[model samples]
Target: MGQLVNIAAHSFTAQDLLRMERVLLDALEFRVSNVTAFTALHLLVQGLPGTRPPVAALAVYLLELCLLDYTLLEVPPTHQAAAALLLAMHTHGTAGAQAPRLLRLARVEPAALARAAGRLVRIHRDAARPPTEALGALLAPIVSKYSRPSWCHAALCAPLDAVDPAWCSC
Candidate 1:
């Protein structure tokens, strides 16, 4: 799993791989961790270069939104991470060149990334105005956490109604 993460992340440092192995092993022993979407999310954020804090924060916000929807579980974590990064780039108006580069780095097909991103957009819209009070409560923590100055108020940023068409052309 760590090797898969390294491949997706484009990180090949021996020390880093060892550390990831140790962490995974420890988590397995404790029965407290699974290589979930967040794992891929972290690898993308930590391994990629030139990813700004705002982009990272927004990506995190999007992934957290995915956690609220059980349907998103069907999407692979690497795909989810790629989609989140793509959406974040688009939202920040930095997708001009980065989108294609991200596609190459994440090794995800443009159509697949677009589809995953579309789901995130729908999730974002639903989360913006949760249908039920219980759902709202479920969303509150993510919103509040990202709304903080520390997270650059990422949750306050408006979700894109749809993914930019250009991204799907890559």
Candidate 2:
């Protein structure tokens, strides 16, 4: 097993290695995880009403944020995806009540989802503030577009500092 693992490590890209590590962690518990949660979110958003543009935008934003912050990679994609959906729902303000149902459909646990969301919320909040020289390059355009109240009426730019700090602890 160790030999095979070493050989695979030499052949995989950084993203592939990280994904494999996540799978190994999940496999130890004998459960499933949303390795393709990004794809799933893309498809899932289309089925919902009046949520496609904003939700999709937020989801993509969250993914990009995760890419910027390697610490977020510790969380599974399913939980991250769920959190993004919840944030998007919050942005829309129309489906906040449906978060549980939406997460259930995505096969994610609420606690895990909340934890992942907290991290993302912090990322979003921090990225929105000034001294954005590092985060601004990637996030500024997104913040500008989503921050607008008229852009699909998404609430993605709402102050995340107001949310519970516990949401970020995994």
Question: Considering every candidate listed, which one attains the maximal lDDT?
Answer: 1
Number of residue pairs clashing in candidate 1, backbone atoms closer than 3 angstroms, sequence gap of 3 or more or interchain: 0
Q: Write the per-residue lDDT of candidate 2 for residues 1-170, one digit (tens) a residue.
A: 44665777767566676688789978887655445658767655655655656666766676666667778868877677767777766655645546546755667655676777778878777766645686677677666666575555342556445444333223
Output the TM-score of candidate 2. 0.60
Q: Write down the lDDT of every candidate, Cα atoms only.
A: 0.82, 0.65
lDDT of 1 by residue, 40-78 (tens): 878876666788899889898899888878898888889
Indicate which candidate wins on TM-score. Answer: 1
TM-score of 1: 0.75
After superposition on all CA atoms, what RMSD does each candidate show versus the true structure? 8.2, 10.7
